[model samples]
Target: MATLNFKHLRYFWMVAKTGSIARAAEQLHLTPQSISGQLTEFSATLDVELFRRAGRNLELTEAGRRILSYAEEIFTIGDELLEVLRDQKVKKTLPFRVGIADNVSKLIAYRLVEPALKLGEQVRLVCREGRLASLLAELSIHRLDMIIADRQMPANLNVRGYSHLLGESGLSVFGTSGLAKELSGSFPALLDNAPFLLPGEDVAIRPKLIEWLETSNLRPRIVGEFDDSALMKAFGQAGAGLFVAPTAIVDHVCEQYKVSVIGRIDAVVEHLYAITTERRLTHPAIVAISKAAREDIFGVGKD
Candidate 1:
């Protein structure tokens, strides 16, 4: 057998992590045709079929599943080796590239992560706001050291990555006192009949909200869509429509804009998660920040 090529391992890793050739290709910035061909080449070199279709999706064959275990172990060791080599040459403060989901408020991000600067270790914290899928892609490539997400964890997350639950908070329906007053009906009935200010189409909020509404058989009439949460709250405060936001934002809007929290949408509870590549987890700086998040942010006591 020929020696295993890094290209084959890379393609296989992405496929296993994303669970879809199409999605993994998008993440890797490669054509689906190219990814498929590379995967085929990988399997051929190994003298085995790696995966087979299961309905509309693909699942690992028995041989593929066995290979996955070894692949994960190899990748982790490879990453750790690279980190050690880089550290010896650079000798700078340890750097951690972190990502946060857009649904999380800026204030929440500041509150949760700003304390990391207090740590004595030479540290660099790089933060960005984006959706879960993109953030995970950056993690897979090692562009980001970790991610903090409020929702939308991908189903095919790589085994070489790990996750920690930071906290849970419910999302609520909020709007100007005038909007709530104008509805003049029970909370459930008002939600069914009132105009709603919502995040634009293609945002994760839309699907989750729609799912929750369907369960109640209540469909809201959307008046407008805005990408900025602050602007959405402003429109809601002016009695334009009801807006969905997290508790922290709702609390802030209530005090600043005098918006009323007509009712809490119990179905929309959000969970915060910290995700990191397996190699980064063992570092002292990553360990410290993760500890802070789990304890201070999630209310989990440190071991």
Candidate 2:
């Protein structure tokens, strides 16, 4: 056996993470040739093939996957050591990487994650926003500590993860004061032909919302659709159209967007979940978030 080189291991880890030599090189500020050479040397030292070519892309072999797992632990410890030394603290700040589904409400995402920061542990939170599928792919590779989503992990998804239901709330419709006053007929009746801003079709709530509209026999004109909940509220505040948000933060939405609640859709419930690879939520930050959301935010016990 040959002596292992940390530099070579780091290069290999970067390649595995980005899944492309060019991308890894860009992230490391090195040339692709340099990274390739390091990987070659690292594989030679291990006496096993690390990567297999698949149509211009690199895929890790079985041996490579096993080595990469150990490499992850090694680099993670190295990061913690550096942080402890730099901060001169007995306990290093823990890094918590959470992926937020693009369609999830920004305000709700904030409320879900806020408890993690107050868990009395020094936590460094890194949030990435993207589509649920893309985030799930990253989570499968152990890149994300957890995912905050409006819906639970699909049972058909190939990834091994458990969805912990954070809480659920009814939907509330909101609009500018002028718009609210202009469409004054009744609760469900006022929504007939009303200008509305709806969530994009990609959101989990879209189907439920559509069903609710049909059930109530309301046919509001959808003037705009938004993937981002914050942007939808912004347009609604500008009187573009009425929008719906979870009732969990109804007060915050109304005050922040300067909009008045038109009505609540109790039938269209919005569920929130914390999806993780671990079946048991043991991370300090994860535990805090789960407890706070169930007890304080969602009021699960009071019911």
Candidate 3:
């Protein structure tokens, strides 16, 4: 009904994300009562209830959902404005929030992200790590500028954007020395009678791993089914079970744990890809960073 302030939009966005005024206030470092007051004022001005209580949880009504979409767009535009203003030599410093899949090792992800942070004094790089699906969802909603993910993300993944495959990289099975010693020969044979720390059934890699196990006539004694590779490695390091991970991650795990590379699987090479919206592709910073990443960082030539 009236021109809204940026703070109101920000508060609204936070509440939409957190689903609770109290939690949103905590995140924004404002009082819950203040947030409630602002929301009340906003609702009155707009002549609509932005949110309603569904028991203890705050549920967004239709009006609230519509307004939230506009808020997201406004925030994106605001960020573009800041980027343009900064490009004019004002030296605005805002971190570029980059997301990566959890399948990537922490060490590898950090290595890739750290160099990108050194691009400019004002170019702060914020890394958000999660599974491929979650990272892509965040990217679609403009919560992330770009994401490093597997190439398996389909063209019809509702991305409504462009994605570039970085390159193919090898991933392999690895386990601690204690676990490795238990294996008779190659990985296929080791599956039987071994305590296995495996990815969850829903994971993309699960079917392939299952097929591989079946071909070897090996049925692993399942110890855990994890979605988190780091946690899998932790369990493996503690001698709970053997973990199968990417070869790129093997060296790092070996150094940290008593792990060894028992065997390598080159056929199942996982690909790295960079994904971004068409609009964001034109942003100077985005263009520069993507170019640098392709030409130097994770570049095929470099690899």
Against the true structure, whose lDDT is highest? 2
- Most TM-score-accurate candidate: 2
Q: What is candidate 2's lDDT per residue for 59-96, written digit by digit as tens?
A: 99989987896798689879889877888865867889
Cα deviation at 65, candidate 2, in Å, is 18
- Give the higher-lDDT candidate: 1 or 2: 2
Clashing pairs in 2: none
lDDT winner between 2 and 3, please give it.
Answer: 2
Quote the lDDT for 53 in model 2: 92
lDDT (C-alpha) at residue 65 in model 3: 87
Q: Model 3 TM-score?
A: 0.69
Model 3 residue 60 lDDT score = 97
Q: What is the descending TM-score order?
A: 2, 3, 1
Residue 255 miss distance in model 2 (angstroms): 1.6
Q: How far is candidate 1 from the true structure (C-alpha RMSD, Å)?
A: 10.9
What lDDT tens digits, residue by residue, belong to model 3 across residues 1-303? 387777877888899989999999999999999999988887887788899998887999988987896787678668877877778755655557788776655655555555556665567566778777777787788878878665556666787556766555556766777767767856667668888888875445667777777876888898899877677888988878876776655666688777777667666565566677763476545666566556654455563
Question: Which pairs clash (backbone N, Cα, C closer than 3 Å) in model 1?
Answer: none
Name the lDDT of candidate 3.
Answer: 0.72
lDDT of 1 by residue, 14-133 (tens): 898878899989999999999999998998888899888987667888888767856875786677668869787643455657788766655556656766677776566767678777
